[model samples]
Target chain A: MMIPLESFHLAEPVLAYLDPGTGSIILQAVVGIVLGAVFAIRMFWSRICMTVSGIFGKGGMEKDGEDETEHSG
Target chain B: MRRSTPAERRLPSSFRDPSGFLFQRDGTLFRQVNEVYREDFQRLMRPDGLYDRLVSDRLLVRHEEAPKEFVDPELGFTVIAPERVPFISYPYEWSFSQLKDAALLTLQIQRLAMEHDMSLKDCSAYNIQFLEGRPVLIDTLSLERYEEGKPWVAYRQFCQHFLAPLALMSYQDVRLSQLLRVYIDGVPLDLASKLLPSRTKWKFSLLTHLHLHAGSQKRHADDAATGKSAKARDAKISKFRLTALVDNLQSTVRKLEWKPAGTEWGDYYADTNYDDQSMAKKQELVARLAAKAKPQSVWDLGANNGHFSRIAAEAAGVAAVAFDIDPVAVEKNYRQIQSDQRKDILPLVLDLTNPSPSLGWHHRERDSLAERGPADLVMGLALIHHLAISNNLPFDHLARFFHDVGKSVILEFVPKSDSQVRKLLATREDIFPDYHEEGFEASFGQWFEIEERISIEGSERTLYFLRRKD
Candidate 1:
């Protein structure tokens, strides 16, 4: 038999969220923060490396940029 | 107080869904859709086209609308009669590949639902059942119209039920799948995270879904208990992002693979003492006995790789459930069924000594192995000695247990002198003085009437066909 939401004190009328327990909510928050940071760092790391390399070799960097844009296009 | 008939009985496990619940009437199973789910149900059946596509694709069990008179009209919007599965199996009873396939099926159903502007309300592994040799979703009311900018609510459940256990089985040990039995809602993310190897954190999917997921759950739980508001953490995810999440999960599940090889029972046939002639003779005896009984369903106990269960299914035209204790053997058997598209045999991992038990709400939501059966026939080939000697189960107890689960039993008695029995006895004392053929018959004769007994030509083992005495 299916358990009723009222029994778990989770019946919020017309609300979209199905309360996934306090533990689950907390866990998702922590996980989101860590994953969000990782994603941010990875995305910026590539751009930062490209900028640093461009400072060292302007002509080579320009050629690489054209190749990248061509591949992306 | 009034006596409730079996037909009026509502399945306890089905009550979790306010949308609908399964009940039986006149020996037929029916689902009662509640009024609270009327709008979603209408959408599923009408403009959404979710029900039609799923039923046609054979991804969901087909159902027919039943008269309202079939159930209490006040509580039900409508009643539907779904095609009954021959046998119901749980996730814990499933082999690694079986669980993986079920997970993939759930994701595929979700993807399909999105195309119809619907989404699955929940992703419980119990909603999927192996029918016609493949996993099919049985919960008709689990689909609901999708709302934009809402996160996939069932994300944590899917990870807990499917991803966590799959990761543990793939990374830690295949036997860890037993944790599903203890954690009915799926393995606790925190526990699974701790049990998993540190190296798993390097894998992006594992890190995000399990390791980070576990940490978030713990922190949220602690904060909430302290009366702290964590509403800011509830991020609004676009439909595109949700679809991408589903795709990522599919890739993660697909990449997690387990090769069934090098296990003890997986290589049983190669090391068996029985020669080709004896093995063929044994198969013939089992097939002939199964044909004589003409059973509608058969359970092959300790069916290593289902070598003999196939004989019963093919020879008797009966649906067979092949059960073995070893995951590798069951994996190989399931792989064979998938490859051949065989519909008659279902291979599951089961340890007869500690079989699947009744669990969930008041221990009634799910059925125990014994509750699911009394199969028409049970084949126990070369398995008696293991229970008798290795596990210290007596013949009388084994006979009674078999009689309780089957009307007819086809068993093989391996003498103490047999190589396999000898190997079992090698590790322990020969305290079983009544382990001989005569002792075996006397004990089993209490519950079953012996019909036929045949000795293999080249082996010291004997096969008996017996019918339970009414």
Candidate 2:
């Protein structure tokens, strides 16, 4: 005998609440690391270059100072 | 709280924010703050001192509390009325510098909010509005208390709305900023990543924010499809790290600059046929006509750097909107407005051929250019030839459009014999047979009554002041 299909009650399925696109959050994490590293490098690169140049080329320091003043002015 | 009548209407665009929504009672606007947002509202108003700081800096719109009766009894905890902006403009209507300024202002507000133990819950460009010739944040409900180790919830929204559009405009074509009109929630990051040049991947900021970010989004989408959605909750960022991220984003924005140059209309005044006498005469005529009408608001179409618009504004003491097709021209106009501390003129980029249309939910959130008007007066100086000859728009069509958008128009008609008209004819075939002064008069005469006409002193152009027929 074939059973009737209308007798059962199905519970409502719970849907996940995603306020922002799931893709957006994942992407942010990957980008944050890269952004931090790049910022650190950019912040220190000029100072490091200046220090190394100063140590290696002591006689050229006066010329560099003049150039810096000219550029700044 | 006072009882609201049946006339109380809520704005559709303001419905999404659960904290509060803007409603109109009679003709005045009011914002109803719900009980759910009481704590945050108190933080913004009281202990934090954020409201006072932002208001004093003029970074945020100012508002005053209304009686409790003004609120809806069910959903409302408090009611407040904000100062009305003269005209509400959308992101798509803004020029490059205007969008950039809005972006910077959002970041500055975010930084300020962090200091007050709060963070912006949303970073939608729609929250910002131009007031008193400057951009100011209008949403009081956009802030929430900051948690110690939660990722900035608005990061993605900020990137899509401000960073993506700014980057695209700076690196690629300026017109690409129009993508904001199509994507009301801001341009999709994946699309932005793909549209950007491959070399942009080598630039640290673009590499991290756009290209790699797009890749991660794809991966997350794939994971979500397989029912792995819980991963989003697992990813947490410290508050210090969040501040650093914001700082980096600010620096990226600061570095991405577009110097508006090389556009056709940018150097228009330099090569114009007008001599000093003719220019002065034109200015005098415009001022006299404007004074006669005494319009409260004026729109200067094709206002290249706002030379004549200023005459109307100053003479009539009216608020003027200076619109141009060229970004460079609008930029120059805005820079002058800033430096001069002028409160009357607001410059925006607009191509008349395809002006900004109504967009967002049900096409009602942002108003179309036509809906914002019938301005008191519209000045179309040296603009007809380009629309009529260059764009192949008939005189009748131009007349109808102008009549519909403004109560009165001051139109400058450039005859076929004019050098400017000759220049336009040099490039294209002379298809406009009825582009002469008589055809112009006959077509516009149907919709308007010609009040006065004057021949400019050293040019073939004749300026006509027409008032729309009832």
Candidate 3:
């Protein structure tokens, strides 16, 4: 509910600063540095995977759909 | 230094930011810049600055520097009088698309701030308010001079305020946005992390920002500058990395969508008890009443998709707030407002049984619904039965409520004979013995002077227009 800012130990707890929730700041740094590279790599890999899947996935699409043997009927 | 009189009241929410605080002097709102933030204030107000760009683009609420006399020499750098927003609706009140649009607006402002050699120091959702049917940043002091290698102070806020709630609403339920009322700062990341389904773990953005980021907050929550904490505290982020982070957030926000479907109120107008002819007649009557009232502002209670509120606002050429119980209904109304570029009506999610109360420090930070009202007209088109019969609210209480929020009231009285009222009575015992036409008039007569009453042509319903008795 209503969390008192003091309950969460902020880096600047000693001062009268609007505690930017220390954990959030650190995570931002971590995500900014690490996730950026991971995301870029993931994007490039996904593109390649999509290209490969685009060719093979058509067969899977046909398998998933109901059989359309209208000419035989 | 002149002492701040009773008339010169500082806003409670304004005390959080050290740069500036908003205060009202003689009924006019003004943001006073502290001496400490003089440089940052100068940078923000400079020629071709972020303020000019944002105001020009209608992304930010416009303001003007107040006269010299308004300044408090002891603690003030300057004072700015901002253009007032007609209605102050919260994030909890917004629909999925409304919240999403506000999110995108925040991100856009952030990027623009960076481009202008500044950064949004505080990304609280409260900073954004809808003006003229568009979300605009109301807080002028949210931005500060950009420092190299400094991580965004408001990233956690942006996630908690905008990203977390948006994700939960999209993945789980639209009602999840209401969690903002309980958690004031935004939905707690850990709570959001717990509430969100496991399937969200596979979504790259949600995984990194919400789940992993939540873990990071929990990990460093109590830790000081020791090993992992030290590394986190002293971490340096490149501009490129920051840009990438913003890009990720932008893409994530842009991708999230809620189609406003499957709710009971989705097709309310079509499935209502009224047939085409009766509905048309009701609309014509409402338009006539609105014109007759000559309202500058109207409040439509239980306005499902704002059917009648739109008529009232359009016919009177006035602004109106359409409040409804279901988020879906409000969302549909909001989407229509966006598509039509309608500027007169603001649709919000509101349960009349327990409307939004006064909130924050001494309950003064956000004004309650009643505090924002006494609207020129309050139209309760086809809603009295639901309150009196379904909710078991007394007619006197309803009358007082109507009188409190509105100067004049236009109420539609749905009789026991009405099919809709019969449907309500069919499910439960009809305990409302005094729920009749004369009973309604007598009860409301205590607070209002009955001016006119017109019965609908095809329906067993009467529309009464009454002016509040002083």
The most accurate candidate by TM-score is 3
Candidate 2 Cα misplacement greater than 4 A, ranges: A1-18, A29-73, B1-6, B69-72, B225-227, B260-269
Q: If scored against the real structure, what TM-score would every candidate get?
A: 0.87, 0.86, 0.88
Worst 10 residues of 2 chain B by lDDT: B260-269
Q: For residues B340-434, could you state the per-residue lDDT of candidate 1 as single tens digits?
A: 88889899999999998899889998999899989999999989999999999988999899999999999999999998998898878899999
Ranking by TM-score: 3, 1, 2
Query: Which 10 consecutive positions of candidate 3 chain B have the poorest summed lDDT?
Result: B260-269
- What tens digits encode model 2's per-residue C-alpha lDDT throughout B124-170? 99999878778889998888767656567787788889989988988
Q: How many clashes show up in model 2?
A: 4
Cα error, residue B142 of model 2, in Å, equals 1.3
Per-residue lDDT value at A25 in model 1: 45
Report the lDDT of model 3 for residue B403.
92
Between candidates 1 and 2, which one is better according to lDDT?
1
Give the best candidate by DockQ. 3
What's each prediction's clash count?
16, 4, 0
